[model samples]
Target: MEMTSRTKKFTYYRRKATNVIMLSSSFFSAIITIIPLFLVFYYTVREGLRYLNIDFFTKLPTPIGEPGGGMVNAIVGTLILIGIGGGIGIPVGMLSGIYLSEFGKNKFGTLVRFLADVLSGIPSIVVGVVAYTLVVLPMKHFSALAGGVALAILMIPTITRTTEEMINLVPHSYREAALALGIPKWKTILFIVLKTAWKGIATGVLLGLARAAGETAPLLFTALGNRFWSTNIFRPIASLTVFIYEYSKAPFKDWNEQAWTAALVLIMLISIVSLVFRLITRSKY
Candidate 1:
């Protein structure tokens, strides 16, 4: 009896030790994963803070040799590009998602889902190339429109998948209840189902916009970057991403500092966009 008791005690302690070791390892792994993100945020703020000022938000880029300039044009252009991209992408993506969620239990729907997955996996630069061929080559010049098209394409797959998943999460019981009330299928989807899932759909839209905001490669081939202020969709436009890419590579100290400032501003812009949208879409209940 003593021998059996000793064996049981030993086994219990061994299991306890093993559990502690595993828990420690998991905690360590999480720390390792988070460290890099924290470091990047730290460094970006540290380096960018030196040059951030009101002028950076309000003035235009000065001549190359001059020291004082701002990225006003780039900021404005970025907003315009996002607006254009959203205008094209959001409706298409939301409609496609609705169709897939509501009536996509067939081969055609399967094909579309497959295509969206594949498109999501394709390189952003390749999408840039495609946009170039479709818009830039035909127009015979790079323009903000071409860049917007590329961003819209990139936004579509993510928005579509997110919308489908969010809508699907709406309970079947809710749909059935609405249908039994003699509501039309379209009305049920539009008013009953979609309303329930609007917050999730908004999150997805914001995510797509965030991803599109930082893209530099597509703008390289399509928008082609302007140095001055211009909002004409058919003309080249400055954007923060392209501005950062170009200035960061330049030998000038002032331009490099500006690049850091732009990076910081870009992050801030995304945060503001998210917060504003969240407030606008705040749940009433």
Candidate 2:
């Protein structure tokens, strides 16, 4: 009896120590992750503040050494491309997610799930190449439309996965309750299940947008940056990512400063969007 008591005490003490170690490791990892974000914001704001001006938000890009040239064109182009991508991707992704969660126990659903997994793993540059060949080459020009399409491809898998998981998390009781009211399966899903999961779905869409916004490789051969202001979806457009890429490669100090400023803008935009989404999800709204 004494031996058995000692064995139990030893196991309990070991488990307690292990849990303490695990908790400390997790705390340190979280601190490490947060430190980089703070450092990045500090550095970006410190370096980029000199270039930030009213003109920087209003005027268009100009010659490399031009003093007053701004990121207005790139900002507009980024918005347009992301808007188009979201418009195309969200509906398709939501539908696919619904199908996967609601009716995807069969062979075809399994195939789709497998394909989504595979597509998610494919590199962004590969998608850009495919977009170039299929959309840009055939059209004989890089345009905002092509970039939007490439970004849409990247957004779809993320949306689908998140939507599927969120929808699945909706309580079975909710669906049953709706059905007991003589509601059809489609109506139940549309009215009850989706309503309950709306916040999660919005979070997924925001995440997808954040991912799409930072992409540079796919936009390289697709949008192919413009120096002047343009609103035409059919023409090449300047985006912050593309502008950052092109400027960072130039041999001019002014252009490099603009690149850093553009990068800061992109980071800030994504962070705001993410925080807004988190707030929306967390609130009763």
Candidate with best lDDT: 1
Give the clashing residue pairs of candidate 1, or none: none
Measured by TM-score, the strongest candidate is 1
Give lDDT for model 2. Answer: 0.91
Q: Residue-wise lDDT of candidate 1 within 1-285, one digit each (tens)?
A: 999999999999999999999999999999999999999889879888988999999999999898887999999999999989999999999999999999997999999999999999999999999999999999999999999999999999999999999999999999999999999999999999999999999999999999999999999989989989899999999999999999999999989988989999999999999999888888454
Position 256, candidate 2: lDDT: 85
Candidate 2 Cα misplacement greater than 4 A, ranges: 1-38
Please provide TM-scores, in order, for all candidate models, with all chains considered together: 0.92, 0.87
What residue pairs are clashing in model 2?
none
After superposition, the stretches of candidate 1 with alpha carbons farther than 4 Å from their true spots are 1-22
